[model samples]
Target: AVLTKGVTPINFKPEFADADAAEGEDTDPHAFQSVANAKIYVKNIADAFCTADAEGCDTYKANAAVYTEKLDALEGDVRTAIQSVPQEKRVVITSHDAFGYFEKAYGLTFLAPEGVSTESEPSAADVAKLVSQVKQDKAAAVFVENIVNARLIEQIASETGVKVGGTLYSDALSQPDGPASSYIDLMHNNIAQIKGAILGS
Candidate 1:
């Protein structure tokens, strides 16, 4: 019953100990957003489920540990890849505002035509304003998100005379066989794309 945006669904029914309690179901549903969040979710789920389903507690804990290790390794790879980019050219523009966690984690500066949420299209004025900002900022590249329409970014690139950088995966994971199915792969692909564009520019 727990739900999270951009996370694969947990494919099981959760049973609470206090079934008849008046309060709503308690869960930290968006648990896969970060390693820390995943850790918390595993702890909470284990405590709750261990009481109800003792036989499966150890298995769940083991799986969580394996996944956590992978996440940690992915974080390291992201750090190294982003660090490979020159510090002076670290800023870039994208079509949507979906990179706050990435910016915080990977030391990237992301400018977007839209605001923090991609719930609506950017107004014409908004696009023009961002174009001006990109030129003023001397952004290294103009990138489009895989999930967003690229026309605005193309327009911005044309206006600024900067090349279309590359497609970045945002919000949703790519297909399992693609370059960005996992968070680590997404970060690596993005950094490589950005670095290539900026260095080539």
Candidate 2:
């Protein structure tokens, strides 16, 4: 229920956790959950404003239109960059299962030894399984997220014989001076890191 494809959002209190749980409700726990998958966010905001003031709503819609265009252009650039790499060299490893949306949108493969959150420590078996997967799939390189410890990824790279790709911004944006300080910059930086590591150009 993380995403409902533009459905109205559900509001609940933390104290009502049990009330939010629905048994037998089929869901993809690992489904893509990112700003990319929430493309309706701006539209929803605009629509909410329309309920208050129609005139002001037009302004929101206009702003959303500009943002949508920027997002489209960003996707195009990322797609082109990924396409430049050979299919066999396109695979990547990250710290966690965060790029499901990007992978589905852009058609690149991403393997992770951890789950969505960095707070949870990955088991040794999980690391071994990911290492085996990296070797079998011939993953291009492993990249550490800015928010996670880099040791695990370095270990994976050491064992898999793949180079450490680079750092990627995951949960939050970096400081203004950092490479991935903005949304568009984050996309460009990630693509540059992956392409540089895989294609070495």
Candidate 3:
């Protein structure tokens, strides 16, 4: 409120069906997890810029077009990579519910103990429930995130008799020397880890 005291913030959060309820719907902010939604976000950004500065509209549109072309290619790559794995084997377990948008867009299932907010802690029952769900769902892989604690994911994997697959960059990119150093790399690295682990298992 303090930061936006004299300005209006444009919100581009994509709404999902089952995720809406009381408490004003626990929306997930990580919409960029999916390239499609990322394109929408880019469009929104471009539109906002054009509205705020008419002289820069053409530049913004041009830049957004160039970038979204790359995003389109990335989308194809993601689909082809994920499609190589069987539909039933596309389940993933992560530290939090950061991949809801990714799951919706990619036809994969992502289970997490904590909700959208990373600060929320799950109870013992919550962890137990997730462990059971992992076993029942035949989860393909359990992954640690660059932004969250890995102990919960490790425990879930251990209980389900699967190893922690790999590190996935969720809310942040990695260092320059790391695998997920950029948005495109982050998506590529995540899908590669998921596909390789699931197929190998």
Q: Judged by TM-score, which candidate is best?
A: 3
Task: Write out the backbone clash pairs for model 1.
Answer: none
Q: lDDT tens digits, residues 78-123, model 3?
A: 9999899898888777665567768778898876543333345556
Q: Write the per-residue lDDT of candidate 1 for residues 65-133, one digit (tens) a residue.
A: 786787677667667767877887788887654555566556778765533223345577766776788
- The lDDT values for all models are 0.64, 0.68, 0.74
- Rank candidates, TM-score, best first: 3, 2, 1
- Please report the TM-score between candidate 1 and the true structure: 0.67
Point out the higher-scoring one by TM-score: 2 or 3: 3
Alpha-carbon runs more than 4 Å astray in model 2: 1-38, 114-131
Q: Report the C-alpha displacement of residue 41, candidate 3, in angstroms.
A: 1.5
Worst 10 residues of 1 by lDDT: 11-20
Worst 10 residues of 2 by lDDT: 11-20
For all candidates, the clash counts are 0, 0, 0
User: Model 3, which residues run further than 4 Å from truth?
Assistant: 1-25, 113-131
TM-scores of the candidates in the order shown: 0.67, 0.73, 0.75
